[model samples]
Target: MISWIYLGIAVLFEITVAFSAGNAQGFTRLWWTIATLVSGAIATFFLSLALLDFDVGVGYAIWTSVAGVGIVVLGAVFFQERLNLRKLSGIALVIGGVIGLRLSGAA
Candidate 1:
């Protein structure tokens, strides 16, 4: 449960990363980028809190995989993005890898 919260934070961190990437140049965009970076750091702190209960490796792997999945989903749903079978299949690989890690006692 706590690990899941960290996973959420990791996803938010990734979302902020995307936000920053989308607006790295313009002075007007600087506000958004700063907000994104600050929020990301805050989100990552919450993520670190979950490490209190879980092993560091498990926390890292779970957070990383969850963030990866979340970004792809967000991209498709929120950004009018296109994800063909190849991309979807790649995401599936991520899922498989996460599951494999869990099954192998990494989680």
Candidate 2:
């Protein structure tokens, strides 16, 4: 239970780092670059903690899936990126896979 919470936090940090990286302008911006680095470090630390209890495959799949979905939605909302039908379908598939994994007792 606690490990899942850590994983969720890790995913949030991962999304934050990814979004900050996009705004960092190839790391040319100071504040955004720092945010990306700090958030990435925090995400990694929590992911490591989660790995203590979870299988690597399951943990990594869930982490990346959740973060990927979050980043995409944030990009669409905050960055004004396009979200076409194809992209929406892809997101649905990824979400479905995440649900499948969770239901498989992959913890």
Candidate 3:
């Protein structure tokens, strides 16, 4: 559905927000801070579009879960962050929860 596409785009932008915020270093860095704010706005815009067709609770859970997973993976690959077994297990649990939510037709 078009709403799902919007949600996906929102997730990507949310991921960008996480990384940009990290690089912002307490908002001391101008460009990264600006990037964080801009990405957050874009992400919220698409999320709003998606929520027009989705249950708000479902849409929000999916958005945060997917973006959190994306941020973790990207952090490992790009920022030399740890990808330990416990974190992987947590990721799996989050994924399972998302799948369950989808199967329940809640999103």
- Of the candidates shown, which would achieve the greatest lDDT relative to the real structure? 3
lDDT of 2 by residue, 21-84 (tens): 9899999999999999999999999999999999998998889888998888988998799999
CA displacement after TM-score superposition, residue 74 of candidate 3 (Å): 0.9
Q: Please report the TM-score between candidate 2 and the true structure.
A: 0.89
lDDT of 2 at 21: 96
| TM-score of every prediction relative to native | 0.75, 0.89, 0.93
| lDDT agreement with native, every candidate | 0.74, 0.91, 0.94
Q: How well does candidate 1 score on lDDT at residue 34?
A: 87
Backbone clashes in model 3, listed as residue pairs: none
User: For residues 1-107, what per-residue lDDT tens digits would candidate 3 score against the true structure?
Assistant: 89999999999999999989989999999999999999999999999999999899889988998999999998899889999998899899989998897788886
Model 3 accuracy (lDDT, Cα): 0.94
* Model 1 TM-score on a 0 to 1 scale: 0.75
TM-score of 3: 0.93
